[model samples]
Target: MPLLGLVSEYLGFFALLAAIVLVWKDSPWQKGTKVAATIGAMALLGAVLPAPPEDGAATVTAEADGKAAGGGSAAGVLAPASPTAGTTPEPSPRPRPEAADYRGMTLDDARDRAEAAGFGVDEHDASDEDKSIMMRLNWTVCFQKTGWTSSGTKTIDFGAVKNGAPCPAADGGAIPWPTMPDLVWKTWKTAHQEVAALGTVPGDHIMASTAYLNDQLPDEGEYDDWRVCVTDPAEGGDVTVDLRVTLELTHPDNGCPDPDREDGDRPDLPDRDDDGDPDYRDPFPGDRNRTSAFPNGLTGGSDDSSDGNGGGGGDHWNCPRTRWC
Candidate 1:
């Protein structure tokens, strides 16, 4: 109970005061005084600081058995502690932990992180309903409250659910938009490398969806028509990178809309759900029943995506419908 609350903070100043008086005041044992003061100062800090966090397994077990509520009726989950009679509220002086991405992690993992960051199991929210899905510690973390501003030693609380439970898609990536690179307009090839250089993974922090229009098919003259189009969460502030974004690609001649495009004219309409011919060109315009799929779109083949970086992706697909792969 001595270090459980803030009243013990004054003990530090008191120790400092006594140490200073002992070292600087008139004393026959001046040499011994300073050493003793140093040891005393260290002892005060050691005793006043909170103890290392208890093991996570123990805490979870305690909550499961209904002992962490600290009183009767077996509280459904950890209930906030009430102040003891005659005790003054304490000021927090402990350092907090740096920000972390808890998404896709397990509840037990999230709990361990919170505890290490100077938080107690009772200090944050987690209902028994949330824990009902713990199967070999596989309950997945779905939501978190902290963002880029988090720093060392600060407390961070997150929410979790069963592995298969529905978790809301992150509003954006875990990294802030300012921190993310400008990937728009860059070829699929270069974009893959950029994210990797920044320590992010494709399909994890980025995704690419490929589509080739009639003009993009082999029927047309060989040309570099496939390029990156729109991205989700558009480039902006405070945006957290969710998983990789889907980069829609089309041939330059296919006439996709582009705000950056110089001409103001809208491109011609597509086949409208019609199929392309054996030559890989749109054969049936505006006929949903006869649509065909042609060659697949390109995304810089290899294990790495992007036409520019590795420059060797030429995968094919079968399209008997409105669009090609």
Candidate 2:
């Protein structure tokens, strides 16, 4: 995200400077003394460069142009929150019930616990070993996508990497990324509408992990300390098109909050209320905050096609509002 803003601002400055130099090529300004003076002035101005706009600001929304929503990840625009108009009392915060047990708990058991505790769970069928060990207790918050859609078997495991034997303990473990395509290439084709990654939910990582798998990351697991939001576009028989975005949060590790630590214990962070159900609220469902960031477009490939590359990734293809032509 830092690199995106920096490159955008620098490119704009370079273009303006180049245009000025080209226009003055044959004029008196091109001569030795004048050219030197102009170059010096330009360099001085460039040195005092203005700061690039912040990424997580309100104005900057994600677009599907040449890339996926949040693919190029410029950061600005925070997701919308529920409205508050009437005098209805706000829901009280609550902690989830204790996890049943961890004895021989399979991946499904872990997923159930996390979801029951208020996190979203996305499954990526990684190698047999990775899948068996890593999935046990990882869960994140999930939102539903509306309109026409189909379910499938394949999944991309962004957070878990195969490490020979079983995955390490939640507190001290590491998941490596295979040398193949990482997050970017995983969604390059259009067949898959949902984009899921492994990381913590935004703004929830108070306790840092002891064993460093990915230090650049601020949170634990894929959902506990990471944030992910994805979109699925609905096809249009008419000229107009439509799309839906789903925000997700997953908890990867099992580190409890430390009251003695600076941030204080936050037992209330996960699905505090033992509701065993997800609260369905469309935070950005049209109207007041209607300008959705994800893009919707038609896709095309050869009529006679295969499953890989040339087939446009899979059974479908959709253009992004921000990254495609």
Candidate 3:
């Protein structure tokens, strides 16, 4: 009935479309109106016609069962080839192909096979329209059933989208950040263990560094005698997932020399002007007239224009013209 209904709708719609198309070029009201009227009359006649009887279907079933009006074999019924008192019954046109054995196949392959075998395919998670339109095999079909059939109707069931959606966070698409555990006072070994337990690799996500890994990185093979002093966010702080965090460690009780400590040690360099200032330490190493430069007249060579005035921009009390105030 559904197929027949489709046929009726298609026929009527095609007739209207064909009429329009055929007369679209040289269309005058008379030709279009005539076509429409003819189609309308045909539709009316079809509606008034009597429906066909379903006797053919009944006759076929009766013949298959070997029954007739007078309690005898049907005229069209063929006797079993073996002339035995009781013979095995013949099979009907094999059941619309079975939908079983479709497991383990991708959703695309499964749908193709099922549909090709005379089953209508349907799916779930359609709200995720993006996932459904995916390469067809994007979501795996977990379960399926060959539904019941009666007369000429059938119901097929497919439990698809059991795998997951295509969007992020549905299948670990979004990065997950675990809270920075309290690894400050813990040993490097223990800290790494805790980081691993939080679903991050030690050497990859968490890095163990001896002071701080700045421009220069220390040897990758050295992590002994060092206690964790700092994590990027400290304890109880949240950090990005998979971001390599430097686990800065401090030497135990200052046992090893701390490279970051300021020991007042200075570098050696030549003083071209030799104004009691090393080239590296002197602000104006090349300028013989000035050993250092100062802004706002704080501490610089005396300015002669303001000298001996007892009130100058470079001197507070005009102490000397050759020196700072």
Candidate 4:
């Protein structure tokens, strides 16, 4: 290509020389010399200029199905037959009975109660420590809350999996990610708002259960009674959060969530069969035959759990039977 361009340029110089010879014929300007010089310049340009190499090699690349592993499977590949317009899609699956309390309270239950009281259950946990129950509840909560169930709970051993999508608000409120109601959110909020007001030490300084203790009711009266030692100091550059919650009733009720609590702070106990440690025991004992459900710390009245935020509070249950740090 370069040599071609150079030759084309030198042709112009030859033409110029030819024109001068024609304009001043036999004027001792050496017409033959001019023609020879033009030809030599053209030859030099053609000799020195570069030329493009002929097309030869081609590149090859591997093709994939465009689907990532452990990602969207077959169903994800299919497109809808028609565009959706002026219509609503079918709702997601509601949580199963396994997701509900004995009192028939699912996130839907909480939502109904919240709506009845001019509010809404902002989010819920589709999963908990109980995998069997969680599996069933996952579908149920996902269905009823559809977009909101994604606020579902995450277990302590969260690994490399990308978190599920967040729960959209039923009433368009803020959505909390990674997990939902049941306990952690309520515990943190109560620690920041309610409990800390009583001059108790902040939970940011304690070693506590990261999950909710449902059957184990909250301790009340003084902050000192509920004080648990911080067994695990945070690692280097890690945040130190000590969560201690004491649920005190503004008014006592005989029909409180649980039966054993006649009117006092319930204690937590240990479960030996599950290979769980004494300090880290499951609060709600399904095999233990306990049944009671209360939202927030309210008793005798059907009130939606408002753990500071609109989401249901973690049902509190503490047992001196099993000491939790």
- Counted clashes in each candidate structure: 32, 39, 0, 27
Please rank every candidate by lDDT, starting with the best.
3, 1, 4, 2
Give me the displacement of residue 244 in model 2, in angstroms: 77
The whole-model lDDT of each prediction reads 0.50, 0.34, 0.54, 0.34
Question: For residues 119-236, what per-residue lDDT tens digits would candidate 1 score against the true structure?
Answer: 5432221333333444427566666664222354344556654453445444222312233456555666666565555432333566555443333333322323355555543554
Give the per-residue lDDT digits (tens) of candidate 3, residues 80-179. Answer: 4555678776766646445567655677888887777777777543223334345666556555656556656544555444333222333223323467
User: If scored against the real structure, what TM-score would every candidate get?
Assistant: 0.29, 0.14, 0.26, 0.15
Among all windows of 10 consecutive residues in model 3, the one with the lowest summed lDDT is 164-173
Per-residue CA lDDT of candidate 2, range 95-114, in tens?
Answer: 33333332233445545654
On the 0 to 100 scale, the lDDT of residue 311 in model 3 is 55
Q: Which ten residues in a row have the lowest lDDT in candidate 4?
A: 154-163
Model 3 spans > 4 angstroms off: 1-178, 210-218, 237-241, 254-325
Model with the higher lDDT, candidate 1 or 4: 1
Model 3 Cα shift for residue 244 (angstroms):
2.6
Winner of 2 and 3 under TM-score: 3
lDDT of 4 by residue, 1-325 (tens): 2344466755555655565555457555577876775566556556655564344311111111334343534333443366578778888775522222212234334445545543323443333322233332222333233122345531111101012323334323333332111221233334334333423235443323312232233443222223221112211221212333433221111112342457534433345433232223333333232222311222122335565754544443322223321
| Predicted structure 2, TM vs. truth | 0.14
Clashes of 1: 32
